[model samples]
Target: MILSRLSIINFKNIAQADLSFSPNINCFLGNNGMGKTNLLDAIYYLSFCKSYSHIADSQIIRHDEDFFMLQGYYDNNGNEEEVYCGMKKRQKKQFKRNKKEYGRLSDHIGFIPLVMVSPSDSDLILGGSDERRRFLDLVISQFDKNYLDTLIRYNKALAQRNALLKQEIKDAALYEIWEEQMSVTGEEIFKQRKSFLSTFIPVFQEFYTYISGGNESVGLSYRSHHEHGELFAQLAEVRERDRILGYTTRGSHKDELEMTLGEYPMKRIGSQGQNKTFLIALKLAQFDFLNRNGFTSPILLLDDIFDKLDSQRMERIISLVSEERFGQIFITDTNREYLDEIIRKTGHDFHLYQVIQGNIESLKEEK
Candidate 1:
């Protein structure tokens, strides 16, 4: 799948904008704080039914604006369809496909696949476990609707179980009910994550080899809080402590994806460049996985990533895009000269857009 057009109104810094995209590689080149990343965030919102940057939908609306709207046209398996989303403060966010309302956010999920490479993604390696967990959950949630439903139900059950634990109810039998539900849901989550990693690890390794020149062995290991062999029994053993803490403390949420370089933690041992490359490699692998499956080819969003790399690594990334490895990428920079330099060396199909304040203008078209 590919986006053919995008329309934004009173969103972020953009007051009102509409632009057509090149089906091959549409590039957005502009300086920082010019709403470059915000533009890509709008596209992401349409695909995932939420903003990529903000936790709340109201944050996307322009200052003093009552509401905001984003619409995208996509070519899905040779059939054209339109996805529209509208957000307002103190009101519900609405989503529609082909002018018909969607009943659930899940209905619109994964209709369009996307892989984003932001400067903040380096956190996936160096940051806390929650960050890595989010990385895994977002990717898996998109491809598997069942996983999404299970995840939602698991979280709800976990919350209710925790709330009950905090209360003064003397019903010791209630703890058994929570444990059984937690075991079932947590086990499903663990199994799906393991299955996904089985597919993901090889792809990640191959990418790391390519990007790192095969110098070091890159590894990803899933480490759970409880032994998979003893998961149920362990949950039973820890029930007392969990109730004292007022939470389900030993489940999938406590599991982690460990990133290692050679024999050391990538976060501690890898250099800045290595960390950035690893992050990019992981995202590329995600793109490849989605592409290999029947899912849509993701539009690569590189948000000020050039600023975080050296010329060598920058060229490496440019080569990947130049080789047409990623479909329809949007890149941002603080200076036009940076993009101009790469554009000078690489002869590829793309368009340049000049962004200032909330306005955007395309410079040239593919000939």
Candidate 2:
């Protein structure tokens, strides 16, 4: 799918803009805080129904603005798809396709598959287990709607079980109700997660090898309690412990994706460049996985990720994306030289835009 055009109003710092995009590559150039990333976020919203940076919809509206609106025109397998999203202060956000609003926002996911690589992705390496679990969820959810729905049900059951544990007078019957539900749903999620990683790890490793020139070895290990025993038994065994902690202590929610550099934790051993390279490779692998599974070619978004990388690694990434396997890329960077190099190397259809304080102008076009 290609986001061929975008319309934005009062979203973050972008006051208003109407822009067209190339199907192959589109580049946005500007300094930090110039709304370059915000432009990309607007595109992301059309796909995911939420901001990539901000958790709250109201927070992303322009200061003092009543609301924000975003719309995208997509070419999905040669069929035109119009996606519309709008939000008002203190009201539920609206997301629609072809002028009809979605009854449930999750329904919109995977319609326009997208993979984003940004500086914030370093969190996958340095942040908590939740971050890693989210990475798995995001990629898997894009291709498998059943997995996403099961995850939602699992989380809901987990939440209810935790609430029961927190109650002063917990009923064993009620606890079992949620625990049973959690166990069933959690098991499905665990199987899906494990099954996904089995196929995903090699792809991830391949990209890492290509990016790092096979100079360093990396590893990804998925750890979960499901491997030990059934989730129902685990939850029952930990009932006392969970009550004491005021939360469920054992489940798929605690699953971790351990990143390693030569058998050691990357967090403690890898340098800045290594860490960045690891994240870029992971995202690209996700793109490849999604494309191969069912999404044809997921849209790729690169947000200010060129920093802290050696020239060779940077060139390798540019070369990789320039290939025909990738499709409909959107990139944001402060350096024109990098964008220029990409254009010179790919020789594919591209459009460059300059962003200044939420304003945008077409810089060049080679179609």
What TM-score quantifies how close candidate 2 is to the native fold?
0.99
Cα lDDT, model 1, residue 53: 63
lDDT of 2 by residue, 1-367 (tens): 8898999999999999999999988999999999999998998889899888747898999999999999999998889999999999999989999999999999988888899999988889999999999989989999899999999999999988888778843667888888898889888999999999999999999999999999999999989898898888888888988898899889989998999999899999999999999999999989999999975689999998889999999999999988888988999999999998888888898999999999999999987
lDDT for predicted candidate 2 compared with the true structure = 0.91
Task: Give the distance in Å from residue 244's predicted Cα in candidate 2 to where it truly belongs.
Answer: 1.4
Predicted structure with the largest TM-score when compared to the true one: 2
Q: Residue 247 error for model 1, in Å?
A: 1.9
Clashes within 3 Å, all models in order: 0, 0
TM-score of each: 0.93, 0.99
Model 1 regions lying over 4 Å from their true place: 337-348
Candidate 1 structure quality by residue, lDDT tens digits, 1-367: 7788899999899999999887765566666788988898888888888777646886888999999999899888789999999978889998999999999988777778888888778779877998998888888887888888888877877787788778845476776676677778888888888889999999988877776667768899998854555556776776678768877777888889999988889998998888888888898888888777645677777777766566777776777766555767777777777667656655666677888898989987764
